[model samples]
Target: MTRLPKPKALLNKQWLVGLLFVPFMAMALPADRQQPIQIDSDTADIDNKKGVSVYRGDVVMTQGTTRITGDVITIYTRDRELTRVIAQGNKARAYYEELQPGEQGIVQAWGNTIRYDVDSDQIELIKNAQLSQKGDTFTGEKIDYNLTLQTVNAKGTPSQGDNGRVQMVIQPRQEKAASTK
Candidate 1:
């Protein structure tokens, strides 16, 4: 039998996790770059000459802690290096998630369509975009996230109804008390 961590320890862990969702400042796990990309789907069509690959029907692609799921996913490569990834959802929204460095939790995003640019390290979520980390969340019609710079730009279209409005929820941080001598 194993004993669980003390309540104080658990509280401290929660406190640390609170900052994991800080808007536009978390870094993705560096080791993920070294991992091989794995893709699974019901059907896949690869064209080496065009450097493009298309996967359909419950597609899932993963590299280390990074994962993407959608109904269709298209990958574009140049010189054998990934250049872009585009995911489109049919019945469900496209989903993406990646682990942050250190003790920070995973960052997740959902949208009708998602485009990722490898060279620029940027991700663009389109149509009912929603991003979340830890307990905090950002929702809008579109969201542009830069992983390298840790920045986010979101936009909303009023014509799309309630989801067209941009919304963000950030949790408050608990500061440690100063030690009295």
Candidate 2:
């Protein structure tokens, strides 16, 4: 009879031991909202602290309207709530949740290799990043937005923050224009 190697025998080397922990490391990472996510990548790194989560790699994560594809995705936690999120990559996109008018409240989204600081509730998008909501949109080299203040500040690039900023309102487009264009 043939027998597979014992579990202990497989993990004698330090490198092997470290390698063995990779899955547990990935599994131990805390993310209440990312379980149904699917990623396509060669490798990954996950860090979680005080409810905030960070994912790094050639990452492609998809969950319903939220799709974050980037080299890194950092999720911020506030009071144990998912207050802010950031994704950084070659390019990132998120179908940020929105609330219809008269429906009480709506959730907003920030997309493209982005960074979100939960304590400050700030969202930053980098490198070909774009933020859009309904018909409102902003595209630049990098974008910094404050969710609490309901304001947006964008720079042409990370280095040049003084060039100027654009302000906008997000709304649903007209039925005619949306279909044709």
Candidate 3:
């Protein structure tokens, strides 16, 4: 005859104590990792507890094709991965651009600077700064780049007459269509 083990012994069993596996857990992982183009700064202070990277003094930060240069650049991280980067420019301008893997271009911007936090997953464009992409340009008091959603937002007074404050012009790769003419 065999005797059943006590509750304490059964609870302590190694096999029973193994990690639980759930198929649904895979959905929790992120799809794309964060990769910046360039990070330039005179100083960089990292805080693991807060999961933030702060760069000061002539800081220029870029990710992939995006380029950001400012007096201060901050990078935010969550789960040991970088989530967002914000560049705070001086009287000078900061830059950011979205491009295909091999595409490259210059993104001109200027303002009080930029601040991005990982927890919020936002790229904040602030101050009297401006943002531009290709031929499109916008000048706003503040903007947010939502990484998760892959979208950009703007909020501020626009440039007069020219709509300098809020401008969006997507360049058409319409050469194929034009060739038919």
Candidate 4:
């Protein structure tokens, strides 16, 4: 059996708390939500009655700095407003990336399937889910991230490789040098 790192040895509790809460406090740029969404794909099928649209063949969707790319993407709208987005990957993993508020850098996620709910401000990654920000990484079978709550929940499935354990890698913060007076 593989040994897991002790909680105390894994990461600094205070730093871990801040790592999980601080940067994600503003998961995306405030203006991103206000920006108009743009999508590009080889083909698109829209069903006005159902308020559903499906795009196939290298679909790319963007709103400000937030971008999602996949082999197929489905968008759901309600009353002309976007309600949800689902992306499924065939040749490659579905990918999502967005610039965080301030200079926190970009957050990126990848999985076989990605689901984003606009109302709840949540993103769910299923199957080979992996998320990373500022060099820290999280990997598991499934990951649910709530932007508003700044929380993350991950589930792992037993397999040959990882032994059904979620993995996290937290990088040490770099200290700035003092200026000479």
Which candidate number maximizes TM-score? 4
How many clashes does the backbone of model 3 have? 16
TM-score-superior candidate, 1 or 4: 4
Model 4 — which ten-residue stretch has the worst lDDT?
A: 13-22
**Alpha carbon deviation, residue 18, candidate 1 (Å):** 16
Candidate 1 to truth, TM:
0.82
Which one is best on lDDT? 4
Model 1 lDDT at residue 30: 84
The CA-based lDDT of model 3 is what? Answer: 0.54
| lDDT, residue 3, model 4 | 57
Rank ordering of all candidates by TM-score, starting from the highest: 4, 1, 3, 2
Which runs of model 1 end up more than 4 angstroms from their true locations? Answer: 1-25, 160-163, 175-181
Candidate 2 residue spans exceeding 4 A from truth: 1-42, 46-67, 74-86, 91-112, 157-181
TM-score of each: 0.82, 0.45, 0.55, 0.87
Report lDDT (CA) for all predictions. Answer: 0.84, 0.49, 0.54, 0.85
lDDT of 3 by residue, 5-31 (tens): 347565444222221211111111132
Per-model clash counts, in order, read 0, 5, 16, 0
Model 2, range 27-102, lDDT digits (tens) per residue?
A: 1122424546555655645445566566666665554434556677666555555666666654435323323334
RMSD of 2: 22.1
Candidate 4 collision pairs: none
